[model samples]
Target: MVQPLDSRQRNRYSRQLMIDSIADSDQRSLLSSRVLVAGAGGLGSSVIQYLAAAGVGTVGIVDDGRVKRSNLQRQVVHTVDDIGEPKVESAARFIDALNPDVTVETHATRITPDTVASLLRRYDVVVDGLDNFATRFLVNDAARLAAVPFVHGAVYELEGQLTVFRPGGPCYRCLLPAAPDEETVPSDEPMGIFPSVPGTIGTLQATEVLKCLLDLGEPLDDELLRYDAADATVVRTPLEPNPDCPLCGSDEIDDMDDIDYDDRYRIED
Candidate 1:
């Protein structure tokens, strides 16, 4: 059932309502959507804020980490007061204050193999803001199995990338069959990302999430977009499911059971 926007809602969302593509109905659709954000770090900061600002009805935040003083640099949702608090809690507080009408579900737990399936099944879509390749790959498989569309964003130093994976499209595995060796990939190269890198990429991820929810605009499905902060350039790459892809290929493996997420492989974002 579509809930009509009240006068206060209309006034509060005037700017967004003015957009040609976003009608009151689209706002209502956004209000009814369920989106799960997989992390509460740099990328997650912008994603969570924008989604709440847009009135996504239910936003599930999954993260086990606590806010640290260092996190304040990019994790904008948290503050000095939030340090030592669970990231999920701090994020929930941020959402509640930003949009009280929006319900926030806080899962202060890590996304592990045992928890991934159950966690993902609860939301219509997911936004990836994970730091490690291990958890990122895990979410990809779970999303593929659940048939839910997920927006993936990653930042490295001054660059970032964004993509979307759904049931019928090429998955992350199709883009990279295996994680790169940690030694060759260098785990610490992008030690501390430029704050704006994740911020920009996360904002784009939120845009894609809105597109997926509203069925408006072209989504990043089947394509990879890399954003270079140095020159402010975006490179788009077409993607296709490899026949030998482990997840969504014709001869795909049974499941993600045999895979080792800790086998660090880093793909340049």
Candidate 2:
């Protein structure tokens, strides 16, 4: 069982609790929540930091990439000295220093079909910070298998998108029936993400995660929040579950053997 925050923690979280929408009970729920954040890159940086600072009980970061000097532009969690270090390790170190109350777990490897279900089973919520559609699809399927709510976010150039996938809401597969071909997508290194693109989307993702954990306010499930940072406008679109989606439709996934990640977009897949 999770322990209640002491006076210091309570005081520290008072501002958040004071919000009419989030009271003491909500704060307590956040204090006991466990969230799994996939990818520690641009979006992951903001998501992990915000969730940790908000006093989430446990935050698991899964990423196998190393911090590069170029990542410093938007991957705020790592510093120049952190370059060459594994992203999950570097992110865990930062979260530890930021809030000792939040337990940080590191999975220093890419999330794959074989490993996703087991990794997700231990957490109450999953944050999708990945940049590719294939992994996004896998994440949606894995979360369905684990039966956990997931917050999803993505950024490209000046545009960003956010949504929540609750048990009955539209899944990622419903958003895109099939994964985009690898040759059609470009990596962040070549595509060039505006520093604020992921920041905006990731912060929104963190907000949804907190709302879901606290059961406060309406979560973003079934709603697509799109931000055109370049134009400074935010738009909302309602998403409905695709009855024909093979992964999370009316037909349930029967066996783990049905999972595969070979079609996932990657720099060198």
Candidate 1 wrongly placed segments (more than 4 Å): 185-190, 251-269
- Candidate 2 lDDT (Cα, whole model)? 0.84
Q: Report the lDDT tens digits of candidate 2 across residue range 1-269.
A: 64666799888888887788876667778877899999999999999999999999899999989999999999999999999999999999999999888999899977777777788877999999997777777777888867899899998889999999998778887888776665675433356699988988999999999888888789998889999988899999999989887767755565446644454522121
Per-residue CA lDDT of model 1 for 1-269, tens digit only, reads 66799998898788999999889998888888899999999999999999999889999999999999988888899999999999999999999899986999988998887788888876889999898776888888888878899899988889999999988889887887776667866655547688778889999999999889989888998899999999999999999888877568754345545444443422222
Off by over 4 Å in 2: 1-3, 186-189, 260-262, 265-269
**Per-model TM values vs. the true structure:** 0.91, 0.93
State the RMSD for candidate 1: 3.2
lDDT of each: 0.86, 0.84
Residue 195 of candidate 1: its Cα lDDT? 75
